[model samples]
Target: MTAFDGIGGAYAENLPVIMISGSPNTNDAGAFHLLHHTLGTHDFKYQIEMARKVTCAAVAIDRASDAPRLIDHAIRSALLASKPAYIEIPTNLAAAPCAPPGPISAVLAPERSDPDSLAAAIDVAVSFLGKKLKPMLLAGSKLRAAKAEKAFLELAEATGYAVAVMPGSKSFFPEQHPQYIGVYWGDVSTKAANNLVDWSDGLLCAGTVFTDYSTVGWTADPKGARIFTADMDHISVTGHDFSRVLLADFLSGLAQKIKYNDATMVEYSRFRPNPTLQPAAEPEAALRRGEVARQVQSTLTPNSTLFVETGDSWFNGVQMDLPDGARFEIEMQWGHIGWSVPSCFGYAVGAPNRKTIVMVGDGSFQVTVQEVSQMVRLHLPILIILMNNHGYTIEVEIHDGAYNNIKNWDYAALIETFNAGEGHGKGYRANNGRELADAIAKAAANTRGPTLIECTLDRDDCSKELMSWGHWVGAANARPAAAI
Candidate 1:
């Protein structure tokens, strides 16, 4: 089912989402006729069986009386695991008479780490830090799910170590912070980030994840430094593994136990220069990816939330210089291409106080372009930077073929077609730097509805990093049979 990818995304990203579905009633057993959407088979449990693979918890509510308890269990499991849950209610059971729901009293938070494990993890981490002359911190994306970002920042401040956030964890720590270095992605690391991380004798890689894409085709090297990992549900330092030690608790405890160590920062300052992202571009020159990044960075405000589609947009977004309060949303794990349109719309609905700026490529935009109409109908103030590249550039970089090309659309005019001139949503096409600046200014002033700016670019125009990354990924995928 289409919902399967979303559920998988939630699981991989560690979001607590609950999905409810309707099924044939218990009395309709073997009738396949009872439900039109049933897989048209006698196996009634097939749906839940498939869902169980991607969800943290899956439950079937066979009776009206059991709904409350079953639902509570599902919710609690999903919350504790920071993953998705599925609840299926039969048709007859759903229609059955039940007592009216009561207002929820305060819900309880998940349990803290095991006391023994927590104490041991902190002691080991403290001991490890005491032995090292030069140590550094590496932040990862999993900190969001662990609710450990504040603690991670506290640890970074309490111990004056230079920090390099893994590529996937960009913006986890305030990028503008004094101690923050850059995004570390092995060979593609920013400025001196990889050097600093590799040179350290001790490393604390908190909440980090390493997949082929994140590691750039598995070329990332931690070097010979001893790694102390405060993973989601456990802490692993050297050879010791402390189970049931939550990341938040371990970080909080480590912050309390450690004092400032200026060795790493002293060395970092001796390096060439501070990291710079997306250097300034000429406003009069033809538009390029760097120019797009530069313009996007200029548009970010403290109240803005940037959404990056899963394509070259991801690499472009990495160049943004986020303000202290700016939020960056990217579905990097289970990267379904068209996820941004719907997701950006949903985020606008949830956080109306914040402005949404989404960068999506033409190939990906076509997949879920219909969601923009919902924005117009709701009068949501959002800015969509559509890159009309005429094809799947990310795919072309990986392995070019006829299927990589897409039919080009007049993307800027789509807003008028969606509204038929009824709604206030506006659209503009940007061919160069001047057009982009004008479009952005107009978008900033438009609050009645969403504004879309389509920036036309060549199909082959993409980040050089993307091309290099794709080559490695292609090689990894095309290894000889004997290598395995």
Candidate 2:
């Protein structure tokens, strides 16, 4: 009950999770026997109702014979919707006999992609591109979620157009691809990358959610460009909308017909890395935010995975290169603070064989600090680089509000405190760049258990990209009311 509110968006955004809950027996209903976890009402549907808001489907398994069908329906709905589902099994039915699940492909309903819609969408996109002098592909995270990464890459290669990724979809597309440009986050984007994208004559965005965060508060000026966008179920090209078109089907069709735009690729300098601007002073001269980013970048390896918190980490992590096979996870759409802590915990468990690293801020860390104990208990060797920026620096950068200032905690001591003399984990506090580097090296070598390295930084330490994004988003959030 206490954690229900936290997963609303998680379910809505199609996060695949199964929550099996135990409830009172259906026979016990209307007996006036109050259940301990109930809402003190005769009706037992209260909890189910609460869960229905977030989950795609909720089922109560009342009969043992019907259990398999109900379970199958719940699972199918969850997969199709890409969301969470609820299944309530009474304590009495816990040992119920059910039909065995045969082949999974036969159990789930087939997802049909309309042939007409797919072909039309592809034709429209191809025609739109053929008329433009410059066309590019803006890829998003949904490409990975919808299992269309291969199709998307094929389309990019087939079209021969320059490719860019939205901030939210970072690492979904291979950054090392020859035609790959850089992240396109509007005003917060790298100057060359943003210009190439915004100035394009045609833009085909696939599996993208153009939320405020991705567009830098809707300041991206791609309206002038002919737009063709595709998601899981629908594709919109210019003004025409095609329904019942799956993202993979559309991309696959586009890949078959997308004309080569070699001229555009040549003009944009394809295969070249984004231009890097040198800082005036050496990175070690002062303990600056950019230097911190550089250190984090240097720490990444081909086998490592990075889980960045929803704040300055987004900007800093973006600047780091993701070697092939390396994964980067961030909650951009939800933008929930402290999400990366538990998220990293789950990630570590799911990918136990891979090296995991989490970059979290002091304020965000406080919200999900308890998860560290579980990581230690499970012996997950994740390196936690906690940024000690005093408070919510991202919020301060956006709106200098007093509420953004939060109470700071002794973050590094938490590992030992949670360990409780168990020696299950290690912790360290670093106040300077040298100390930070040393602590990182220690974390890299320590494989005994999870490690926490608290890096003390200036209160205002933030990336330039964050400052620009914050300003734009702040302005949008503070829109004038009723035109005054």
Candidate 3:
């Protein structure tokens, strides 16, 4: 495959991309002529050489002892560069004698915040927070990656700021928390949600990437307002230029310096849920799907790990009421459509004690349904919930009737076709609310092996909240410059 294709594209999106390549040693290059694609190739650093053009940094390691240091350096370089990095490890060196383990140290520690600079930044943030009628806290994946969830939540609570979690940080905060304003991306972000972002006078962004999807391509501007950004690396007031750069280790230090007051808390306490005013008579099909989501959520155990596929299935699935100990996972960075099924398999293998539940649309499930065979082979007790709406529902919403549909498949029968019917796994189907409840119950009770619950839903029975958001976004985009 060409560079920038396959997983390489992940790096192109300004996200961290690390490539590890196995190559022959420099001295053995002569004998490993066949490994080279072209003749007269003396240097055996093809991978590293090629990677240098595409990656921010590239290095070749000939000794096993240098692998850890090289890897750490590559990762640090990639994060700082905000681009991809590559490392080529010679096959011979991989098996070489290990070096003596030294005292471990953080390769990339947070830069110390200057006392004066820190005071100025905190003063600006505190002044805005104190003055703003409504302030918000937007938590991003960086907080989760840095294990700063408690600090984030504490800050949000202390400031009485309504918290809106970025899509990638779904489980970073408890959804049931009164201060939580719901997900800030995908289908969950409605006009009301956008309004909340619009209404805020100040935004305190903690470890978040204020990217397109998260802000709906800057539709929700934090302009005319102060923006306080805190991360391991840098902070920007308006996110235009770098205002201050701090090492990650200084988050606790920064948090301690900022004082929380009752006035900030008072404004946040006044925040209320702005639910969509639905019609008295909801469509029969929409009602059915809602009930199905409700049923599945109710049946899930506290320790369940839910993996939601990208699309309408994800939109509907996250609306479900998750239990206290339940955790959710999705490929937010890549937004890969078929990630759920295979990712669920990996999660099941990695976490054997927890029950892994995968919620996927029929369209996305077909992408990597073959992994179900592997699941059966491993006897991993995973549950797959197929929302069989018979098409790519989200795409249809974005581009109505524009070849977004897909051919139907016998979703439940696929499990039987794989012979995972009894001891290994079982398959079940549901069409309505009652049937969905039964199917989910059966799947939960089947402790021996994996289970596939295919819920046949009407393609028209999509999420109203999602539809409204899409319509608003489209309308906003279509409006003329001055009018908007």
In angstroms, how far off is 16's CA in candidate 1?
0.9
Q: Which digits, one per residue and each the tens of the lDDT, describe model 3 over residues 1-484?
A: 2443423444533446787777766567766564544344666655566677777778888777787777778878776655688888776776677765444455565434566665666655565567766677777777755557776766666665677777667777777676676776644563234456555667777777754444544555454436767765555565332344452433454456555543433544455455543222232343256666666666677788888887766666556555667887766566667778877887788889998988888888888888898888788878888888878876676567747788898878778777634446788887666566667778778776789988888887777855755565555556677854
- Using lDDT, rank the candidates from best to worst: 1, 2, 3
| Candidate 3 off by > 4 Å | 1-20, 24-58, 63-68, 72-87, 106-120, 185-194, 238-251, 254-271, 274-287, 400-403, 417-423, 471-484
Full-model lDDT, candidate 1: 0.86
**Please, what are the lDDT tens digits per residue for candidate 2 over residues 218-328?**
898466437777888898865789999988888888889877886556877743455575443352455666666767777787778898898898888887778877888
Q: C-alpha displacement of 90 in model 2, angstroms?
A: 2.6
Worst 10 residues of 3 by lDDT: 278-287
Clashing residue pairs in candidate 2, if any? 14-82
Q: Compared with the true structure, what per-residue lDDT tens digits does model 1 show for residues 168-272?
A: 788789988989888887666765688888789999999988777777777775634388878999988667998999888889888999978979889988883
Q: What is the TM-score of each candidate against the true structure?
A: 0.95, 0.93, 0.78
lDDT of each: 0.86, 0.81, 0.67
What's the best-to-worst order under TM-score?
A: 1, 2, 3
Q: Considering summed lDDT, which 10 consecutive residues are worst modelled in model 1?
A: 100-109
Clash count for candidate 3 is 3
